[model samples]
Target: MTLPTLTIGNKNYSSWSMRPWLALRWADIRFEEQIIPLGPRGLGPNPDILAVSPTGTVPVLELASGERIWDSVSICEWAHEQAPEAKLWPEVSIARALARSAVAEMHSGFSALRKALPMNIKRVKRDHSISAETQVQIDRFDALLQSLITRFGGGQASWIFGHPTIVDAFFAPIATRVRTYNVKVSAPVEAWCQTVFSDSAFRAWEAAARKETWIITETDEA
Candidate 1:
């Protein structure tokens, strides 16, 4: 059988691509990957990407049946659908609702933090300064993480909702950003970041990212 294809950009710089990629990997779904190099500084309008992606972006999932799904979160949702047994979201109704909320917030909000600290998995900038708006978002994220951990963490599980889920996959990229920029975070948040870093799937992706020679100069400067 032909496997589904995930079209992605540079692993070193594409956080959006990383999200659904992690979801699929962690869910143990098999898929092929096609990498289309992004334009300089990661600016796009690339005909190659545009040909396959409706949004002219990376991280599009093309199924064997010829269905195409775009956007990181959308692709993640598709992964969940493909493997419901993976339990990508929390099984508990309330917990699942909260998990979806967290993923959606990460999807739509956090613009300031994203703008200030773009993900560059191969690079680390210790003691990097962030803008006031970025700090506000970081503080908000910290509070959200703390709240989730306290309510659902059950002491032993490091991931939000007490186990790895779509929530973990969605936030994996942000965790990389925190480490990349050496952003100060609370102990619980830091522990969660460690969990993300230590994940085998994430490690595989990071290893590939480090090996990639493509450089988006704009994110490299960040």
Candidate 2:
């Protein structure tokens, strides 16, 4: 089968792109990747990316048949459809439903946290401030992780669903964001975040990020 092509942005800071990228890599799905450079003058919607994706965004998944999916959530669902054995969704119906809902929340509910803590893999701000509203969201995130870990996690498993799934990919950026901006969380959330941060795919992305030439100067300074 011809590999699908995934167009991404800087691994150093494109948190949205990291979602489906991590899902594809972790699933062991063979695919091609095109990294579009992003910086002060190169931020999207770049013409190059706009030429390929209708949304003019990164993380567009182009299938061998030429079908293109632009949103991270949709791309993830499509990948899950193509590889059910990858266990991208929980097998149990109820768990899967909750997982879907949680990821949806992550997609739409954390604007304040996101604005205050843009992801920058190259920088670690140990003293960054979290506004009260952002802190509430962060606390909500920790509670969500805690709920899942206590409800579904088993021995030695670090993923929220007791295994890697779409939810992990959805939340992967938040994990990186927390580390980059010194956001505090409960021990369980911290542990879960570490599990995500340590993922082979995430680490691989991090290594590449460290080597990328593109720099978003403001993000680099915390």
Candidate 3:
């Protein structure tokens, strides 16, 4: 029998793709990946992505049953349902609510930061400057992350809520963005970012990202 397949774009630049990809891996769900390189500057009218994705975007999860999940968060939710024992969300009630909230915030917010500091795992720009708008979002991000760590981090695991969850998976790309752009964060937040970097699954993804020759010039120059 065929396994489920995840259709994604360039690993180096596709933050949306990274979310569900990491979630699936962390949940120990076995699936294949299909890479459809984005068009120049990562703005695609690409026929390949359009064929599999209703929204013509990357990170579409095609189940073995042939049903497709198109949104990143939806795909993560699906993975959680498939593997509830994986504890993708926090087990505690309030903590789980907060984790869901955090994921939702990431899903709809942070436009400035997302645009100004695109994820480029293969590159580092320590001298990159943050604009006022981006700085506002960054500050918000840092505060939210620090609060979560302080409240739910349990003083043991570096992950929020004491373990890797869908929250961490959703923010993993932002952690890479912080590292790639040298964005200064609080010590706890920094530690969480480091944990994201050190995860074996994330490392494997990073290794592949570094090997990809595809470059979106807009993000490359960012």
Candidate 4:
């Protein structure tokens, strides 16, 4: 059977790209990827992609059946439909609602963090201080992490949903931000970052991101 094709941007800075990519990899869904390097303007040419997603945004999923899934959350939702057994969301109804809420919050919110500490997984700097806006976002993230731990974490699990679900995918970009910006986070969040970075597929994506030839002016090396 033909799988869907996922279009994305430079993994180094595209937080949106990280979401569905992580879910797809975790679900073991075999799909092709088309990396359109994000420029300073944060867009590129791909008439087909633009036709499917008018915004010309990255992380657009083109299914083999000619169905289009734009937006990161939509892509994850589609993935869940394609791989129901993957448990991308929690099993419990309430928990599932909360999970979807959290992921949606990440998708529509966090403007400060996105503007201040954009994802740059390959850049290893000595000092990584966050801005005031970034700190606010980090604080919200801390609260979210604590709530998740209180609700579904613990035991042998390393993620929010007691298992690696789309919630984890939602925050994977934050893991890179925390590391890249050196945000002072609690031990739980720090440990969670380790778990995310340690994932083989995440590492593979990061590796490819680092080797990418296109560089956005806004994300020039420091």
**RMSD in order of candidates:** 1.5, 1.7, 1.5, 2.3
Error of 1 at 215 (Å): 0.9
| Reference-based lDDT, each prediction | 0.88, 0.86, 0.91, 0.82
Could you say which candidate leads in TM-score? 3
- Clashes found in each candidate (C-alpha, N, C closer than 3 A): 0, 0, 0, 0
- Who is ahead in lDDT, 1 or 3? 3
After superposition, which runs of candidate 3 have C-alpha atoms over 4 Å from their true positions? Answer: 41-44
Give lDDT tens digits, candidate 3, residues 1-222.
799999998899899999999999999999999999875644556777889999999899999899999999999999999999999998989999999999999999999999999999989898999999999999999999889999999654398878779999988999999999999888888899989999999999999999999878878897
RMSD of 3: 1.5
Q: Write the per-residue lDDT of candidate 1 for residues 24-84, one digit (tens) a residue.
A: 9878899999999875634557889989998898889999999999889888888889888
Query: What would you estimate as the lDDT of candidate 1?
Result: 0.88
Q: For model 3, what is the error of residue 131's alpha carbon versus the real structure, in angstroms, after optimal superposition?
A: 0.6
lDDT of 4 by residue, 1-222 (tens): 987889888888888998999999988899998877676543566565576576778789989988888889888988888888999998999989888888888888998887777788777665866677778888999889768866688723377777679999999998887887677888878878888888888899889888877766566543
Assess candidate 1 and give its TM-score to the true structure.
0.95
Candidate 1: pairs in clash: none
Question: Is candidate 1 or 4 superior in TM-score?
Answer: 1
True-vs-predicted CA distance for residue 207, candidate 4, Å: 1.6
Count clashing pairs, candidate 4: 0
List where candidate 2 sits over 4 angstroms from the true fold.
Answer: 42-44, 155-157
Specify the highest-lDDT model's number.
Answer: 3
Question: What are the TM-scores, per candidate, against the unseen true structure?
Answer: 0.95, 0.94, 0.96, 0.91
Q: Judging by TM-score, tell me the better candidate of 2 and 4.
A: 2
